[model samples]
Target: MEKRRAALRLLPVLLGLALAPAAAPACEPALNGTRVESSRFVLSYQSTPIEVGKHFALDIAACSKPGAPEPESLKVDAQMPEHRHGMNYAAKVTKTGPQRWRAEGLLFHMPGRWELSFELRAGGTSDVMRNSLVVASAPVRFTEEEKRSILSHGPWPPKLVPDPSNRVSGNPEAIAFGERLFFEPRLSGTGSVLCATCHVPYRGFHDGRARGFGLEDVDRNTQSVVDARFNRWFGWDGANDSLWAQSIRPLLDPREMRSNATTVSRFIRNNPPFRTGYERAFGKKPPEDDEEVLVDVGKALAAFQETLVSGRTAFDDYRDALESNDVREMQKYPEDAKRGLKIFVGKGNCGLCHFGPRFTNGEFADTGIAFFARKGVVDPGRQGGIKKLRSSGLTLLGRFNDDPAQATALATLYVEAQHRNFGEFRVPTLRNVARTAPYMHDGSLATLRDVVRHYSELDEERLHGDGEKILKPLHLSEDEVSDLVAFLESLSAR
Candidate 1:
């Protein structure tokens, strides 16, 4: 009887031990149909249950038959649930064992549930697996002083500055004439193309291409003509010192309008409607020669482009309420978006680069884009622009300029700042950013979530300029990133 009792006690202990491992949960079940034996593979990460306005990292691992042809190569991908977009995860692979692999990447500004997927391939075989996780909303926590500071500001106005040379700030006739010139396809070398071809009115006045496709392929992205008048300097490289000067570039570029002074002059003088319009605006008949007509064309185009200002968005509404101390209106915005706004201005420190009503300081920075095709061979960016400005006889200070005296001063200042402007590209406005995909000067990023994520977990090596130190890892929670993206989306003109 003693032996039987002892055996029973031992049996109970053994049973408990055997059950412990099973009860611990078997690695959350590699669900989404992940098959271990297959040479081909597909897998996804589990969704992260977090909020907007945060940052997160994803790491996935896989094991295969030791000698199974090394499973070709491992691939990982992720998709945002709410936005129906793919996140730009800077993926990297590490070998954990002979047949085991781990893939990792950072998700910067996306919020809400996201799906991660993995794929494995070996010997013409493949398999896939997927999983989802929820990203929650972030909490708002602003200080009293912060609230006071926000409340002290006022709403931004739609201000237009008068042109120093012509005193034509808001001339409706000039704008109307400029609008006609903008849409006229005859202006280009290929009559099929017009200013509207490169600066599409629907696409924020910018053609959605990497570099513009002109008479031939041009080597620069077409800058947005919207709100060009407000800009102190013009062009991606700031080659043109004024809006009118910038307008003349496309007309002369072989790949753009390809129309010389003579051709443009002939078109304007021969076209009765254009002649009448020009006469009304300039108080003179269209110039008999091409040089004079070309100048008028530049001026007209600038006038039309000046009207492309941004309209109010949800962020602006919230901003106005905050400025007026209207607590009720301010409270109407999503809590996550508000927190994101805080991150943008404070913790995230985005305001340092993106400031003022237009969300840009009109400055340039080297954001570390891979500009060089071959190692050690760099695209000299603004440096090239400086050289072009000096050599091109088209600048305001040059013989072709309508106001060479003032243009000369502007060009001189720009040249003096050449050292400070190397590799620098202008800061783009964030309005309607959601609609324009493939971010940055080079269109390197594919989506806004990717952009937010990039800024959230910026690679220090990529920011090859003076401000890299300021853009440290935000260490934001997943929710915080989402909130920041939400706030940015709210800035889009609806």
Candidate 2:
């Protein structure tokens, strides 16, 4: 039994020896930094400020005591003792000199106390030495121009205004009725799906799927309705001019709820709870006309969704501080994020399209994403959106519009589809962006890092001839990528 145990132990050492490289690259002499000592050896390590989530390297050196054998191998590692988790990636160690080594690809993914370990193996024995480190973010000081650019992003939670085209837009009863309908599965033809299936409240109002699924898969990602009240146009293709009209599309689509106006109105009229709620919202019994009841139900849904605005975030506090010239308050923001903000407003040119408190221009643009839906099918995007908008009777210019003068209908009337608008899509709001993953209209990019990389190495050749002139390859360094991701994460609510 003892012999078997001894042989099993030797297996690991033999495997490690077989896996090691024939030669390790040379490194400079000992790093003159933090030093630690063991009974048989003195160890020293040097590294930059270990900020959370940023990758860094370590230079290490060991001095053996007189008459003691040098270590045959070495390994370095770090872990959070309290959380019982290590780094997402392992460090690659290389012996640089007789007593020096370099460890690369070390990253601390979270802010907390970490226990760093260095293992020395010699004469069939190993010694593990450890040191504790406290990691926190250090913010940078901003220049006058940078401060001005940062301040423009927000004072946050912008004041809500009632929609001029929806008479019951701000009514509490209408909002309550809409809330009930939002979760009512019987509103669908199959009585199995509801708005919450795709716009799940817990998942940042997103379904977290690459494409939405109701009765079947839809060709686009499920967008959040968190701040729908502030939108100028609705959907990725901007097919609907009003939120209520957009709400009605899913009800009628065969791939979604698959219910006609007659079925929807009959369900609302026959159900006691829905009937009572509709009466409270519309100030009367459910209407006899199916089309009128359907539009009213849509208006009620829009009223409730308008109240779903996101809360204030860290970026808002920093922007507010910058506006008032409160240096101390501004300093609380991360240094890497400040660097990212500079890139965003200046070199990145992102603010040109994603400016304002909502962090969007509320317009459409072609960002070079592929428009192919299948082998021979194209999504058509804004071009098709314009065609649908012009043909639909549920627009701001239609009879259902509550505005007497039709003040908001001008855009709907004047919007002509141009050849350049072929693959254009609505620019999404950036508020609470970190929470909404599987990004883009098709949900192709899976992470904020991936989205940043897409722009960093943008394929300018892939862009259409009429694409936005401001877009170009950023050629960002890895550090800059990390900084930008940090800045974007700051936009999320705490």
Candidate 3:
């Protein structure tokens, strides 16, 4: 009995030790010896552990040294450690009092863990404080009506509408000859620049520049050669109606290829390899006439450009897996990316503008980019394209085109309807968006996060001048924003 009582007494002592609190780790001092009065900052949201397709907010404040001037700017930023994605925070600041400021803003998109940092700056001094938060995923809810509407009707490998009179389809010899002409610098007037110089093979068949510089500065973004055959209209302004017609524009442009019909014809006639290739493709010797020779050159260049297609990406694989209900393949994708995909196709509403296999609908909208400033200095876009199409001699209506009849009709129709195409620009494919930074028509935004933030908090006032409505704010959480970016990166083939 006495031994049993002693054992019971020992059990209480052991339990007490197990329940004791752990010793706190020693706190490290700041580098500049600026003591932080209160390291804690509050970030409250509409929901805790935010879900996909939901909205949330972060509220932050930090206490600093006594008599410290208000921070010049109280900035907050976020990072997703798991996905290695982040964004610079854009918050509305409210002065709570001296040395205390509060920041509040929305986070839109999907669920994930996010690290938020507050940059408190006063006078010349600055300090950063950080905290972590978790956002949980939610169940997907789709309606039968919505599901039916999402079904894609467009044909895969997109239908190629070939001209019956041209007889150019599946002509291997013509394609091979065209490839040679495309890379040859001799096609240009200066002989210093080749077609490949502007239409690069690796970089989405486009040189990464806002405007191309050739014999002189050309004021227009370099259009991608990939999927040129799929386009109903060509160029940023949709100026050209046919591939053959579009090819001749750059050759004759004083600032671009700068080669007239006479110069181009003389060079091709003298080049033995080019002459042989042309004879094989056309079933005749190189054309003697300057106009005929220039037409043939344009045809050859178009043939080569039609072949640049994007390789399959992770998103394609995931999408196929989802459609097939292949749970095994679906599970293989990065979990965060999968969550991001749900947000992209659901709450983000990016699919409204960027849709289909190519991630573009081939339509135009005022994305609120600052293309035109003053009345005189305007980037007229489609307005200028309509004028150029009607006035230029190199258009499809000209005798130099391969299929003049069909090309001319299409060009005429566009010219007649020019008023409807104002302020419009072709929506570019987003296959390799991650590699090509500085998004939009003008290449203004520096990163994908910046682009998202722009759309997240877009103001209608900024878009007033363009006569277009601004994109509404998304109000996504920090974690959800990171997931959306993660999903976008998965679209890159690399």
TM agreement with the true structure for every prediction: 0.68, 0.76, 0.68
Which regions of candidate 1 fall more than 4 Å away from where they truly are?
Answer: 1-139, 144-154, 373-378, 392-420, 465-468, 475-477
Give one digit per residue, the lDDT tens place, for model 3 in 1-494.
Answer: 99999999899889999999997523322222223333332222222334444444443434434455545667656677887877443556665654444545535244578776667776687667666777666654445533332333122345555543244534777788888988888888898777878888777667777667778766566777776766656887767777766887888887898888988888878888888898888788876788877877777767766665555677677666666778789777776676666666667777777777677777566665665623366666767777877886666666555553554365355455345355667777667777665566665676788877777777666553545452567776666677778878887775
Q: What are the lDDT figures for the candidates, one per model?
A: 0.68, 0.88, 0.65
Q: What is the lDDT of residue 450 in candidate 2?
A: 95
Candidate 3: lDDT of 423? 62
Q: Encode model 2's per-residue lDDT on 32-85: one tens digit a residue.
A: 777776666678899965777678899989876665568778899999999898
Q: Which regions of candidate 2 fall more than 4 Å away from where they truly are? A: 1-139
Query: Cα-based RMSD of the predictions, in order?
Result: 13.7, 12.1, 10.5
Clashing residue pair totals per candidate (backbone < 3 A): 46, 3, 6
Better of 2 and 3 by TM-score: 2
Instruction: Give the residue spans of candidate 3 off by over 4 A.
Output: 1-166, 373-376, 396-420, 464-466, 469-471
**Compared to the true structure, candidate 3 yields what TM-score?**
0.68
